[model samples]
Target: MELTLPKKLNASQPITLETKGLVVIGVNGAGKSSFGKCLLDQYGSLAKKISGIHALFINNNVEEPISEEENEFSRLQSMITERLFMPRLSEYEKLILHLQSEEFEAAVNYKEACKVNPDLLPPVTKIDRIQSIWEKIFPHNRLVRKSGFIELASGSRDSDSYKAERMSDGEKLVFYLIGAVLCTPLNSLLIIEEPETLLHNSIKNLLWDEIEAMRPDCTYVYLTHDIDFAASRPDSKRIWIRSYDADTRIWDYELIESNESFPEEVYMEILGSRKPILFIEGTDTNSIDSRLYPLIFPDYMVKPMGGCQKVIETTKAFGQLKDFHNLESKGIVDRDRRTQGEITYLREQHIFVPNVAEVENLLMLEEVIKTVAHRLMKDPENVFNQVKENVIKLFEKDLESQVILHAKHLVRKKLETTVDRKITTVEQLAEHVEGIQQNIHVQDIYTNIKNEFSLYVETGDYKNILRVYNQKGMLPQSRLCNICGISNKESYLNLIISILKENKEDADAIRSAIKESLGI
Candidate 1:
């Protein structure tokens, strides 16, 4: 089934949805609810809209009317009101009746089959199916039949059972959702608004997967503002609602196509933001780049792209789309063991390679150390000297390994270029192999790297050492925390982050120092 969007959303030709699942996502006021309502209206009786704010009040004592017409009308009225009170209670009663009827039918069939086949297995009832699914979702809790009503049981004893109506809001929501879907007619379109509502992150995907598995005939339409939830359904067609014009009753929306080079979540996020993009290397939240880059570059929408290569690729991809998006893009990556030539090349591509080896090393910068020391009422000069001495002592002890690692990086980088060259003939391929072997002088490379590294160690140059050192635990090893009167590395990092957040002067000082060191 295809439902064309409102004509105003697309003047030339409105976008149409497929029978397969589709996720409609946007910010809070971007007409996601309106879009779902439109689809429900278009599809009419074939589509059922489940409100994000669906009523969770399930009263087992409520009785259905004797007249079928009255019951149907009541259900219609409740749906029109987004399933609030009377309809929800009536629906629960109907579900129980349906389950009871299925149970009776299964028993009758089993009795008849027993005479012919004593070993015949009994068919699973609707209640049994629900119980099985509930157990998987909530292993600690069990659903039990008590006094002709479904009750929640915490233990094996009957005394542990409680009325289903008394279940927590989240539990009630899950029960209502499962019952509604199972009760829905075959081949119906299920329009679920904010499906992630009241659902824990760990189980949101699992719940939807189980529901979809149970109802393979139904097409799911999830309307949500949660990008993470929207991205979770990789198979679903994604439509981003950009804006809604209340006066014109028109929406500004577009279908988001998959891009192999750019991630769907990152793309959706960038599309929603108005600021320039800053792709940094780290995980989305926990890493140092994620925590620190935003405070330093507040003008840009800082997105962590995990690794240095991804940061470079994403930045370049965004740059290519700049004409259409009207947004500038750049990337920041660790210095690592990149040589001056490599740094210069990356800088020309608008990818900023920092002076520090990695984001962790940023905390050990001279300016950052001094600023942190001053914040703790310690003498900046004395504290920094101690940090420098400790770092140099550590580097001297591990000098051979550090030099070898740097040489290996340079050799690998060089070989990458050589191996990428095209060779059309066997002679050329043989020549290429021989050239690589002849050019790669391990001892000479090691000697050069050692000499370069020794200069920093000999002069006790803390900044340059930070640029060359790839050790992640160097801060703790250097005992910078002790020198600055902080408790530990975590506390020191938190203090720096707090200073960046609350103290503008120190934040600027640190940012300026980093930018100057990086020459960005």
Candidate 2:
């Protein structure tokens, strides 16, 4: 029968396959496999004869199957010839030979014996047809490897063989991928309903590997509803089908581009806290985004909102609070005469493309630039660079202020000099400040962290503390000095613990210091 891809899409079917991979998605009865069968008939190598045995008919118990098909084929011939015309014995034997898989040769023979006046001769016509198709698909000389090695790949869930008769729907689907990849037919197509069904993540990778290997000759098309796997592809092309009316028999397809829609807001809220996000448009970004942000952006999150929708959400929820930053999107550049209102609005708000108009986060500052182009090009390193630079600026500003304060103190003590005394006074002030800095020893911080850690143990917030520690290994991975954000491991709290253990300082010292500091 002839089949064609209808101009009006019937339901989940590929209109085209411009890339190595294609996804056809819809609910059941969408005809996901029909497209595949059409391609198979057109491009798949034709056999002089084409057919396959249903596994239920194969007798693997005897270590062979030909023993059965041949017997069946021969018996049919005898029945046809009884007081009737006996066809060519060659045709009967040839048909029986069609069932001769090397492993099932015994069954093939058995089936052959059941027939009378069998046609044992085989024809090369079907073989020639297959060769013609293979000529286009296979190289001039496909490699001939020595056989007799057991080479079964790790089985997918579908390949599990509890029993052939009791196979599940999911298992049967997986069986197609397994058989198609293993068959290595030069020209064919493997069409499956849902590749994601019953597939574990680890084995899912194996299925894709098989698909890629078959791409040189075979074309695969499967339907899926897996938004998690679906959204991972930055440039995924989807044939989106929707119910046109309350009850329509037909499903139409549209080419969905990456720029069309956006991820939902809930995902932005959750993933926004954990990792930076790259803002793309989509429906299901949050739950999946939160799950993958840390894996993708280990350093800084590329938030999809970029304070666009997030800023708006913040404004709506916390407009009463003084700290709330408003969502200000810079729509487009005003080409003609600009006004003060436009300039003021532009100056106060982050300039983002107007396509995105959702708000999520209500906490952080919204630093808007005129365009999304600059932000999209930034790497994770650029984020860290900003942090490091800001930290240096903070420290330098504090350090210079402290030096000025010390210089003013010297001036009060009558150390003011018109010439060389300025330089000498600066040096003396630095020396005094250095002496005070050395007085803060870890024996102090450790005694301090010990008290704090002990209190944490009492309050049961220690579980939360342990969680933070586990997140970063204590050895060479910790950030804080276990006291302040200083040297926690080696010199500060670490050294104090060592000294106190050796010196046997009373733990009461911490309480005493605390009480004195409290002026109790």
Candidate 3:
């Protein structure tokens, strides 16, 4: 399973191609396709093992066998072209005739092969497998066979299904992939480059699932820069190929151990460039980290990750990548309810925790809130104090809900723990109860529960709860946005950005603070 790659393209470690599969992820030009070809080269020919309409071919044209020296782009370009130039139904007429005459059983198998998971779509016959995939891609439609051609139509068979040549690029790509999978023999290696190419994001997962059904026996190696798609397949081992040297002269690769998802552009920026990355916990869509961090540390590429743990995990994971040993990576996360010691542990690992409870809390600072209100043309005179008063009122109301919620959560958690302990003790007692007449340590389960409840009641302090709530004034991000009438984090940041545009002095202050904090 340990496959050593070529010396020029030095692998920092031997690749373990586990029976499950290998997923190759890299920035563009990081040699995802080249690595796949190298794997194909190392594994030798699939000619004897593979069958069907030629898994490696483009259309009916037999592709030039892969050469060791060929670059990734050339191979991908050929594949894309072949996928586009797939034959019409008329072209398959002769094959259909031959199947009907001599290879009837093979035809039957091909038909059955086309039939996929019922959840994929309504069931279709064998020849309609390609149609099934196509319809799924562009639904409420049907692909019907007519005189020597397949027509795409809206629902009814009376409407003509368009010819293959007339199909949309996505449809063409889907059909080609379906054919490639169905035609290929099980247990053969299928190398697909950027299956996301020309395909919509919505259909990406479904397409993979359908193809997987066609050839569960086939080992798939997907070469992609898509972090989301790659991360979605936790079943597969992900290999991240990156540049090793400072000048981007040498390329290196490593396997990502954790399920850390990053944007494709972030990978490109990290691997090839010298800029230090500011990794934050959350996706770009929802995280203010992407918007605010870039403004503060313009020199760094502010990349958003999945969550707090993911931020820490990725930082540690990347540190261990021998190829990227010199890669400067840092992580930032919300303080949340983490203790100072917990924050210190993360900081030691180069993960930064904001002083505020959360990133949203930072934006709600008096200056920040005032600036946002002024920019939105609110009463600038007492905006800060007005907002503070409103926020406090909101906080008091929120506390009412929080107290009940927290109390319920605590009671439930304690009850569950007590039940678990009781279950264990009773099971042990049952095991030995038959032999022993009396057990000195044994207490009635109901009595134990009553004692635990008394202890829980003694621990409850309303004064301490009130003091904590008042000290934090913690408004959930969603609740804060609701009060502001802001739909989301992005909108809130956008308002801040608008404010900064008009107030140069305030912007300068923010910049100064950023530079001071970063020691720039």
Candidate 4:
């Protein structure tokens, strides 16, 4: 069942969550669980416990309700070891709270004491009283022999026992998730942070599907940096967060449009640079994509690939000028999720631009270039010049032209959006002004990107598209030069043909290089 969020929640972009599930992902100190508590309190205390916390976590505090400072306090758990232990202790106390309050007073018979008994039972004075209190407070906890709560095993000797805290961290995390789920009603809201942490890789993938299948009435959310997690859900609404530096404060958040397709780009933007891209959907795939690209092209920047679909996304977002390219794992790719209506909206708004595969596709092209270069190396000037000329002519406008056109489109969009802002008050008008400034900043960035990369981009379109050199040598034995119609008098094609004709010893080297370049 859909737990419809308040109108204020809807004020942000209407993220389409088909099920009740939601995920919040960040580094250890990003306050993911705290955000969940705020959600629970706002909605009425659904999840009563957190599974695994890195440090001090405070919640359900009797005095001050959660506020910015409290959130900040909890966010520092990763920084301080003592802080991380807060959640576990807090949970232990909540579970045993009945031992102190209700039972003690009831056993002493507070009201009866004023009349007949005069004293509340000081502590667990009697075993029978202890058993009675445990039953009342932890009724759902199910004690077989009345000592501790039951942990149901799939198949056992019909026993009631708990190995709860004694399990591994990953197992405890699973229990924590289950406890969090149990605290809420069957039809309640549930949000989890990166639930995959401490989890085994074999189990990581199956976890979400298992969760989604159970209890159709429950709503859920999952925030993750894991590409498999992101790409796993076809229905997930990707919210790409980009940090913008503002003069007034420090970092700010903005969304990158169509982010699910470019997990690497979004990941790098959120995570600082220098961290290698390690995780991608279906990482073990074709050798060309996962292995060769990373090994041979060590000089090029390689991020973990997120299926074939992200290849297109990586290209469009980063404009494909960067040194690295994506390797397409043929088996797994994501399909774009635009309804006919949304596609129509984009076209009418002039948002349609040719999709160029900047990531994986370009990687293939680079391999082709290396192949061409090695094949002509022996012939020197004549063969190299010819190949270079053809490459230059072929890619003259493809990259540069596309980039410039998109820059103009962004400029037009920035203008249109500012004009559409609703300015009902001076403060609202000031916000519009601020928005305009950001738009202008984006415009400047676009312009600068266009200026810096235009030359290489323009020449790359045809030149960059690589093919296996069928001529074997730079020139074919059968065909005359298309430009000069010469079979003998010569061109770089002839030079390459001459080199190949004489060299039988280099065949093994050439073949190996081809495999390397093609990432076969």
TM-score of every prediction relative to native: 0.79, 0.31, 0.57, 0.38
Specify the poorest-scoring 10-residue window by lDDT in model 1. 52-61
Off by more than 4 A, model 3: 1-16, 40-44, 47-129, 132-139, 244-251, 259-275, 279-291, 301-325, 335-346, 356-361, 364-494, 499-505, 514-520
Candidate 4 has a TM-score of 0.38
Please report, in order, the local distance difference test score of every candidate based on alpha carbons.
0.81, 0.35, 0.58, 0.42
Better of 2 and 3 by lDDT: 3
Residue-wise C-alpha lDDT for candidate 2, range 31-108, written one tens digit per residue? 444434544555546311111222213332333334544777786676588426743333223332342243255445
**Model 1 segments more than 4 A misplaced:** 8-11, 57-129, 146-148, 155-160, 269-277, 284-287, 298-302, 318-329, 385-402, 424-427, 437-462, 471-479
Arranged by TM-score with the best first, the candidates are: 1, 3, 4, 2
- Over the stretch 388-451, how does candidate 4's per-residue lDDT look in tens digits? 5664443443445545555665566666656644567988877777777665776575667556
Which window of ten consecutive residues has the lowest lDDT sum in model 2? 356-365
| 65: Cα error in model 3, Å | 15
Candidate number that wins on lDDT, 1 or 4: 1
lDDT of 1 by residue, 347-456 (tens): 88799988888778888989999999999999999999998999999988889999988999989987887683568898988888888977788889999889988999
lDDT of model 2 at position 273 = 40
What's the distance in Å from true for residue 227, model 1? 3.1
Candidates ranked by lDDT: 1, 3, 4, 2
